[model samples]
Target chain A: MSNEETAGSKPSEKVIELRLPSRLGYERVAMDAASSLARRMGFEGDRIAALKTAVSEAVTNAIEHGNQHNETMKVVVLLTVRDDELIVSVTDQGSKSIDEAYVSRVPNISEAMQKDDKGGWGIWLIRELMDEVEFTKAPGGGNQVRMVIHLER
Target chain B: MTTTRQHIIEISFPSEFGYEVIAREAIATFARCVGFDRDRIDDLKTAVSEACINAIEHGNKKVHGLTIDIVGVYDGNMLQIDIADQGIQQYQVAGAPATIEEKIAGKAPARGMGLLLMTQLADEAHFLPDTNGTRGNRFRLIWRERVETLEPEH
Candidate 1:
């Protein structure tokens, strides 16, 4: 595809669908989609970069911790722009419980904790970068992490 | 005899976002001193920002009257940044077996993805628990030579 051809391409008014494989290499693909959506929504510079960082962090969570890099599973990123707010919903097929209290609480101990961290830290970063973050489950079944960042006017 | 021209900057902030800003300025200074390219400097800034933000938000989380220290070193070609915060050590987020989407859908919970981004952002990233057991967190960001000139533009 030519650069002009691609640049002229517009973000679909409908939900932009992306099927990211459950692998480490597909991270860039996901980041591109998220950043493209952010720019199209008129997010400039730092705000755009912030959106990319948040999106990448969320997708990385989906791949490494969520899907456990399961080959059979797939990650779906859905983008929707509402006014000055950009809403991103990333869904993946994994079975686990969503604990809001656990995700938000600050860790209070590390004496017995190993220096080499085994797991933990993605969601906290997301909350820090985005204006608002929430974890909501669909009635049908699946995990949905909704992240919203309000673009500056 | 072999010598590497590495410059170090120490910035101390008291519960302020200045920690992040100073870290960035230190990076720009180190990059110019080391003669790194524009693109490379930008990359270093992004990676450094992520690390500094992590330390301020996670390490200093609401703790007042604490200082965050950042040191930038330019080894002729490579750039190394060390940022420290004296706060209780904890994984900002937990790693879950389910993806973030799944967690948001209430099917599962999201876990430690921040560390992953930090690792990917920089060439080398590692966290060291305070060896003195004072609850200090030290995070490092390292990258290779990015350019061949070290001149500042006026």
Candidate 2:
């Protein structure tokens, strides 16, 4: 009953795929699903919290920016659990391409406070929290953010 | 519940013995956000896990390589979940047993003993035939937005 099957990747990776509507609160589904996998993989409490926040930010970005809040568009979340790390990939059906200039920008607290919209910190926060982060165009021509967190004993 | 627009979450995974843990957690969280009480969510979780596992075990005779697809929709007033799998066919249990779609025809009272929890927990559940060129047995469970309801007798 415990036979491990590969999830369309490497022999050791197990995947859980979720296709979510491009909506705001739907990100919670990604957060809970990733955290559940992280907890089972023996991640500490704080690590689990970080994973949730990273997931939330990535999915929200996909919904608001990539899909442009289109209800018909889908935000696809892939939770891949490996022996050493957990990799989360959030991709959207891009109605708009993500601006490459803002991918790695660091936001200043005061400067963001002055802006009318207090957003734009999500991409920065994801980089700071995760062990490895990368942004690339997904196979479906959408924006995809891949974030990985090491499972430490 | 005051918010407008519909919410949909679709999940797919390989048909295997495990993985029910992840699916159930996702479903429960979605249910909670849609305003179901804690008790209803718990019941929902159980039914979800069992129904998925049963699908895997009953379909194809070989669960390896098959896939389970679930689509959940919340429209502020009700939640409808469609669970479908790509199996060769459904294997029946002993006795004058029936499948889920059979319940609609009044051919059976329940979807065998395996799906008893789903029948009990959901306000309405039925097995529907494949449409849109999709394959496999599909089961739908419907629950209206939270309201005062009586508890079942033990």
Candidate 3:
């Protein structure tokens, strides 16, 4: 079972895609799917947990910010497993420009806590847990946040 | 596609995790009507979920009988969503750990990520406190359709 053939367009890669309604209930579905994929990629313990958290945050962001809790909207999650890396991309139909969504620096924790601020931490966790994070405008005007976890690390 | 008239939808529901689906689905439908593609729609879904969940879990703390109000507006190529929760507790913002070692310490709670996801997923995300005591915590998310030049008709 460990040596099962990889699936997808490329022989060495496997891809799993899901289109879910923009609902918090569906977040669990994405998280579970991501956890299973991470496990299949031989991730253990903390790495698997990290992957799950990252995926949850990403999907949650999509359903919340991208779709604005609009039921008619759909959140698409794509998981690609390659020999060296696991890449997950969560795309939403939001019109936010990529330049606007990108955060250049990690927020300072003490300052944020001092103000009693009540939000602004999901992207940082995604950056910390994943090896590489990219935000781009998806085809047809929405945004896509792509996170990659290197298997060897 | 562009429209001269603006469309607005408003809904209020209890601050429970279950009701978050209603908000997400409504926003998504509006986004689709505004002509957002699959990828953009997904982004809207995640961002809205983060905002709504934060309001339910943290802002209202799942307090019984509390409500979260959602307003979605679509104008031309722009979509705006506002989620407001009754102010029960002060919002707690999560800051980044100073050191990578501290970040890896595994002691930090996962609550802080909601705000970060909001800013990253939406074009503009803002948190407004109800200083006047009328509204609660108001989280606003805005996305604008990029104007693409069409190829000249041959």
Best by TM-score: 2
Q: Is candidate 2 or candidate 3 better by TM-score?
A: 2
Deviation in Å, model 1, residue B10 alpha carbon? 48
lDDT of 1 by residue, B1-154 (tens): 1222444434443434533543464456446545677876787777777777777678878464455666666556677888788775554343323555666787744654556666776788787655777677788778876455878989
Give the C-alpha lDDT of model 1: 0.63
Instruction: Give the candidate number with the greatest lDDT.
Output: 2
Residue A99 CA error for candidate 2 (Å)?
1.9
Ranking by TM-score: 2, 3, 1
Per-prediction TM-score to the true structure, in the order listed: 0.43, 0.84, 0.47
lDDT of each: 0.63, 0.82, 0.72
TM-score of 3: 0.47
Report lDDT (Cα) of residue B143, candidate 3.
93
The segments of candidate 2 whose C-alpha lies over 4 angstroms from its true place after superposition are: A1-7, A113-116, B1-5, B60-62, B92-112, B130-135, B146-154
Ten contiguous residues with the weakest lDDT in model 1 chain A: A1-10
Task: Show model 1 residue runs off by greater than 4 Å.
Answer: A1-14, A107-114, B1-154
lDDT of 2 by residue, A30-133 (tens): 99999988888889999999999999999999988898888788899998878889999999998477788899688999988888999888999999999999
lDDT (Cα, 0-100) at B88 in candidate 1: 56
